[model samples]
Target: MPATFSTLAEFRTLLTHAPKIDAIALGEAQDRNGQLTKPPGALGRLEDLAIWYAGWRGTARPSIDAPQVIIFAGNHGVTAQGVSAFPAEVTEQMVMNFQHGGAAINQLSKAAGASLDVHALSLDVPTQDFTQTSAMDEAGVVDALVAGWNAVAPHTDLLVVGEMGIGNTTSAAAIAHALFGGQAEDWVGRGTGVDDAGLANKARVVREAVALHAGGDGLDTLMRLGGRELAAMAGAIAKARSLRIPVILDGFICTAAAACLAQTQPDALDHTVAGHASAEAAHRALLAQLDKQPLLALNMRLGEGSGGALAINILKSAVACHSGMATFAEAGVSDA
Candidate 1:
């Protein structure tokens, strides 16, 4: 596909018209849930999630089909500051963990029965030997993301985007400030559990990074501070919407990338489901702008798509209710 959007408004309109919850399918799902062996409303949110999934896919019997998880790993220049307890080298190590199938996301994905693809995006770090993929520039990010979308386009019914980059929260805050035009302090937060002094340092780093790339456009901001993984995530979102595939976003970093994508193409939000609200205050602001209510709020700040894996179970429950339950007419139950 061509990597062009005449205007942000045009992109937004394209996303808005993307796949939506199917009211008819949702109604059918609720009816089926009522027909389940359990009492009505007994299944709680599980049933609700199933109905929502059915509606979102516009199918009375929606399935995850080829469930795939894309984990984008990169390094951040802002990590040079003491924002995180871990060093930038850990990003490479964790990418190895992902390749070796030992990370939390790997285990959770296995438990959830979802396939995984790890993309080693080049940002500020040297390319390593763990599944070496091309580094993404502004245009490269868009193209790589679109290619990823096309790779899984035909098989998957849903998409989950996860990221791993040390000091990514710093990059996220900078992007958030640029896209939303907020103070760096307003977008900055304690990433990886930084204490008072550490947070202050992180805030300072963010302010400097934002100042470094004062202006240009969204793509410029992304290239200057945003990791290649985040850029690819933004592109993946656009491609996903173009394919009408639903995506579940992870944490602050992923949400920030989504925000960048949304700024470029507002309608992308239409196909996205906020997995959870991060403890990061900036995440709250980002979700508010998207007008998305998260599925969970366990104060989780892990950036390996753990939240997305957790949310997948809820989505599965929704699918089960919609596909397995019976309707009132089939169950001989009274409408009244």
Candidate 2:
């Protein structure tokens, strides 16, 4: 289905209304964790992650099932500025690759026993160059976001969002600069392994775009600079939170979307997790803004949701440890 939005303000209201996680479940989950067979805190962050899910799902013993990775595919007109190593058509090619099960995310998701879906957005049109004008106006953004939100609505247990857009890092950096008030050089990264020349061009393009939209509000900044995929992910994250689902973000571009949602609603990241730390320089700063510690550090810069696919096993492990293990009483083991 195509995306639709009544207005920018109305869409913002939908995003901000995603319900907060239930804290009462947190206490019960923690108490159950303390009574588990393992010593207190022995499992460390795994225990913490399990409890975090418990609060979101409102389940004392949260279990992960039917984990799905949805990759949003779009093309950025900003590539005309030489921001990425690949050309714009590669976005369409990669989307085709995903459909044919020839991409890294396909292999990773299969190995993890998770489902993978790809949404091809703007197959015929790239977002207009934001350095000149808005990549997508409020109406366009609403359509993209609604598509993403519906793509994610089917799965309630675990959702991982990845992107397949060329030049998206530049768009993400522009959003970071607007929302975080940072210089473009600090936010731009060597997307797709750009060389020295391409890196300078990427930074320059981002800086120019950020300047174009300076002093604009958050939604305005996003509409001006952020592309369709990022808008979709932000909407999906917010909507998933409303459904009490946990979202694992893929890499820098995906995290940038999460950062947008968090900037809009501070508690938005409460139900989110960083799949891994990207090799992208700006990703660390973006994660810091959301206060999310990644579950992996594979030094990956690929953006096809590969990192998120890898991290799905870790989340499943947390679920297994939380639900499968027996308590001291059930195991007939007494504490000394």
Q: Return the number of clashes found in candidate 2.
A: 0
Identify the runs in model 1 with alpha carbons over 4 angstroms from their true place. Answer: 1-52, 123-137, 143-153, 212-220
RMSD of 1: 5.0
Candidate 2's displacement at residue 303, Å, is 0.8
Query: Model 1 TM-score?
Result: 0.81
The candidate scoring highest on TM-score is: 2
Model 2: which residue pairs collide?
A: none
Clashing pairs in 1: 21-55, 22-55, 50-318
For candidate 2, the C-alpha RMSD (Å) to the true structure equals: 1.7
* C-alpha-based local distance difference test score of model 2: 0.84
Pick by lDDT: which candidate is best?
Answer: 2
Per-residue error (Å), model 2, residue 55? 1.0
